[model samples]
Target: MMERPVRKHVRLKHYDYNQNGGYFITICTRGRIPLFREGDRLSAAGMIARACAEEISNHFPEIVVDLYCIMPDHVHFLFMAVGTPYMASVRSNPTISKVVQQYKAAVSRRIGRPVWQRSFYDHIIRNPTDLEETRRYIAQNPLKRMNSNG
Candidate 1:
């Protein structure tokens, strides 16, 4: 089920993106194809994915890099609300949502096409243990992408 970068057709949902917590999020391409998977190797799409991963590192100076990975089709992040957020939180908040929207905007601008799904998945980190584990997962995602046996 793959398509082009969808427009902001769907209504945005409510989310709690701030509130002093760590977050683990995964975003996919339009549909669920391997936009990130290419052969037994990474594709140029992977570079696009990398662009996404490098985002927080290169975003509004306030953006911080907790942990992240860019798969051929999806991206994961273990980021936190450092200082003030990108956008304020709404009932169906667009704080983290804005992060995702910005990611899509950048990808689209770079690829000359929309390269992300209309929405993303996010989970606020609950504890230190889960936080560490999630970070490890994000860090190891590249190896998993590179190795079938990994």
Candidate 2:
């Protein structure tokens, strides 16, 4: 029998993921493939991912998808959760990790292939300064790539 390798824990310990706060997340394609094209030429798989990202708010009312950028190999976005009375009552309110997993699953189903890495990268927004900085980073990602390519 083959032993399964243990994966490293990426989430913060003792942190309540359901708590109302802003989260910046990055979901990379499997092996960091450049699936999304540059400029207006987004790939079909990328379109599915974009749609899934936009629809997260509809599926989970507490979540609000803020700024987002779909790069060639990865996608970055900022989402904030505004917990309401309804959210508090629900024992399994959707967390950022769950939302990202759903997004990846949706894209994978549409494309008929696994399109995501094992886990995503996330940063909890601590303040307005942190939020602004993350937003700027996401927005400039495409431009940075374009400059490098040229």
Candidate 3:
């Protein structure tokens, strides 16, 4: 009988994800299929993904979508979790995983198909320098892709 390979755990152990902090996240399409770009422009699916990402803050008040870029097969974004008293009163604890899952689900529902891979990649922003670098990376991702493609 063949055995399945074990997937490595990607999240930081014992870290409080719901605490106030910034997170850099990357989510890719299933099979790394390029479904979000076309000739330097975003496809319909990409637009939906963008809209959904933008609405994440509305759905989860504790989260603020700082910056985001949608590429052909993946997306990169930075979000800040600023805890709200109202959220605490409501007994809602929003985390990075929950936010990403909701965003993916919204995009998939709007597109009428499953479009995301099982899990996402994340980096916890440790300081001002890291945050600035992450912002630059997200801002420059499209240009990098354009240069590489052209």
Candidate 4:
């Protein structure tokens, strides 16, 4: 069998992902296949993925889910890590990587197979303006997709 080519690491080096901040993340399906829709509603796999995303709050108290959109082939979501001294705890210790891993793992398990690409894409939201821009981008993804298809 032919070996797969190694993928380059896209995450920023020397960055502390566990630090308090907001992150915009995009996770695509393996091979960029559209597997999340059945007519106008979400498929079983899509529903499972959505559940896993929502379940992040239960697993990590410091992470808040905001402004997420699940497209036919990918998902875009914002995560806010509330890393205050009062909120810091062993149980809630999770970096952005850990959060994505747990979410992908949960969805894979529920679907009985892996459906995600090897790694996800993320952008650190630097300020309120950045956050709002990313939020708007994510919210409008479906319309963009619709327009593109038409």
Candidate 5:
């Protein structure tokens, strides 16, 4: 019998994801299909995805979507968890995982199909430099993609 390859764990263990901090997240479309972009513009599905992502803040009051960019096959964003640890516990604040799950479901429902991969990639922003760099990266992602494709 052949053995399956082990999937690497992407999250930091023993860390509280609901804690107040900044996070950089990337969610890619299943199969890397270009479902979100049409030339230099976003497709209907992309627009839906972008809208759903923006609505995340409305649903999770403690989260603020700082910056985002919908790329051809992926979306990148930075969000800040502004709730304090005591408040998080008192209100049962949504974890980053939960937030991403809800965003994916919203996009899927609006587009009438599942568009995301199983899990998302996240980086906990540790400092001012990292935060600024991530913001720049998200803002420039579409341009980078366009340049690479041309």
Candidate 6:
């Protein structure tokens, strides 16, 4: 039998119209923590996580943020890209992934520890079906968290 070449899962390459640049990203802490404690206030870790997400948005001007939810352990975001998808040309440009790296690095500096996982979970939203499903997931993540907390 002949051996097949191993393939890398190049994100946008797998999708049809990589130019349709809307992404919903989910980022989580290295260890899932109800980092917020004591009062009903966000803990130091929680604040750091939020700052990371905000930095990602600030760094990636191409990404237009539509919505976001900053939780104790993870962050959710919905954003659209203004130009070609990050993969279209790799155009010697800083893409969403690089922005995320910057966010993670800054956060690690703030905490004096590695805070985030290396890679994030992202999905390209195409039509109404995908959009609605993603929105619903983002909307209900809080309820899911509350249930888990209880």
Q: What TM-score would every model get versus the actual structure?
A: 0.70, 0.89, 0.93, 0.90, 0.93, 0.71
Residue-by-residue lDDT tens digits, candidate 5, 1-150: 999989888999988998899999999999999999898888999999989987998999999999988988999989899965755348755799999999999999999999889899999999999999999998887788778878
- Of the candidates numbered 4 and 6, which has the greater lDDT value? 4
Model 5 residue 136 distance off true place after TM-score fit, in angstroms: 0.8
- Model 1's C-alpha root-mean-square deviation from the true structure amounts to 6.0
**Stretches of candidate 2 exceeding 4 Å from the true structure:** 1-6, 38-40, 85-92
Model 2 agreement with the true structure over 49-91: per-residue lDDT tens digits: 7888889899888889888898988999899888652444565
Task: List lDDT for all candidates, in order.
Answer: 0.68, 0.86, 0.91, 0.87, 0.90, 0.69
Ranking by lDDT: 3, 5, 4, 2, 6, 1
In terms of lDDT, model 5 sits at 0.90
Worst 10 residues of 4 by lDDT: 84-93
Candidate 6 per-residue lDDT, tens place, 1-150, comes to 999888556466655433446678877887765453334466787687666667665776666677677777677888666655455456523466765677778877887888675578788887889888888888887778778878
Q: Which runs of model 6 end up more than 4 angstroms from their true locations?
A: 1-20, 36-40, 84-93
Global fold similarity of model 4 (TM-score): 0.90
For residue 136, give model 6's deviation from the true position in Å.
Answer: 2.5
In model 5, pairs of residues that clash are none
How far is 39's C-alpha from truth in model 2 (Å)?
6.3
* Segments in model 5 whose C-alpha atoms lie over 4 Å from true places: 87-89
Which candidate, 4 or 5, would have the higher TM-score against the true structure? 5
| lDDT string, candidate 1, 1-150, tens digits | 888775663332554554445768898888766776576565777776666668654664444668777676787887776655334473322366676678778777777777777677777778889888888888887787568755
What RMSD does each model have against the real structure? Answer: 6.0, 2.3, 1.9, 2.4, 1.6, 5.6
TM-score, candidate number 5: 0.93
lDDT (tens digit, per residue) of candidate 3 on 1-150 = 999999989999999888888999999999999999887888999999889988998898888889999999999989999875335356545878999999999999999999999999999999999999999999998998889877
Clashing pairs in 3: none
